[model samples]
Every structure is written in structure tokens, then in C-alpha cells.
Target: MNTIEHRLMELEAKVAFQDETIEILNDEIKVHQQQMAKIKRQTELLAEKLKESQSSQPMMSNMPEPPPPHY
Candidate 1:
């Protein structure tokens, strides 16, 4: 092959490799995005549950202190 043709083939191969790499990276990004969304939803649910639990509990300050073991 002529020098110009050989150079063009080499550039084309490089471009193909880059395209493959970009596709792989894009797929990974999609998976990460899905996982992040799921984690965010779970965190929000947990926060809500924690809030409910805290609200249901009585304030400890209002309760009388128990007698010491000396009784």
C-alpha cells in the first residue's frame, strides 16, 4: 500500500479503538446512574423512617429517674 493509504488505515484503526472505548465508558456511566438513583431513593426512605421513629418516642427528660441500686 502507498504511504498515504497506510497512514489512513492506521488512523482508522485508532478511531475504531477510541469508539469502542467510548461505548464501554458510556455503558458504565448508565449503570452507575441507575445505581445512584436507587441508592438515593433508599436513603430518602430510610430518612423518613428514622423521622417517624424519633417522633413516636417520648422525651426522656419528662420521665422520672429510677432509684439507684442502693434501694
Candidate 2:
């Protein structure tokens, strides 16, 4: 093949490889975004449960503790 034709073929190959890499990276990003969304939802649910548990519990008194025996 001629030098120009060979160079053009090489460039096309590089471009094809780059396109494949971009598609793989895009798929990975989509998976990561879905995972992040699930994690965020779980975190919010846990926070709500924590708040509910805290609210349902009784409050502590401000009274001082008595001294132990054998002072």
C-alpha cells in the first residue's frame, strides 16, 4: 500500500479504538450513577429511622446522682 493510504488506515484504527473506549467509560459512569442514587436513598432511609427512634425514646432527667455509700 502507499504511504498515505497506510497512514489513513492507522488513523482510522486509532479512532475506532477511541470510540470503543468512550462507550465503555460511558457505561461505567451510568452504573456508578445508579449505585450512588441507591446509596443516597438508603442513607436517607437510615437517617429517618434514626430520627424516629430518638423521638420515641424518653428524655433523661436533670437530677444529680446520689453519692455512693462508704464516703
Give lDDT tens digits, candidate 1, residues 1-69.
699999999999999999999999999999999999999999999999999998899978799999999
Question: Which candidate number maximizes TM-score?
Answer: 1
Best by lDDT: 1
How far residue 49's Cα lies from its native spot in candidate 1, in Å, is 0.2
Q: Please estimate how well model 1 matches the true structure, expressed as its whole-model Cα lDDT.
A: 0.97
The residue-level lDDT of candidate 2 at 61 comes to 56
Which window of 10 residues has the lowest lDDT sum in candidate 2? Answer: 58-67
Off by over 4 Å in 2: 61-71
Question: TM-scores of the models, in the given order?
Answer: 0.85, 0.81
Model 2, span 1-71: residue lDDT tens: 69999999999999999999999999999999999999999999999999999788865454566778877
RMSD, each candidate, Å? 1.8, 2.8
> lDDT values of the candidates?
0.97, 0.93
Clashing residue pairs found in predicted model 2:
none
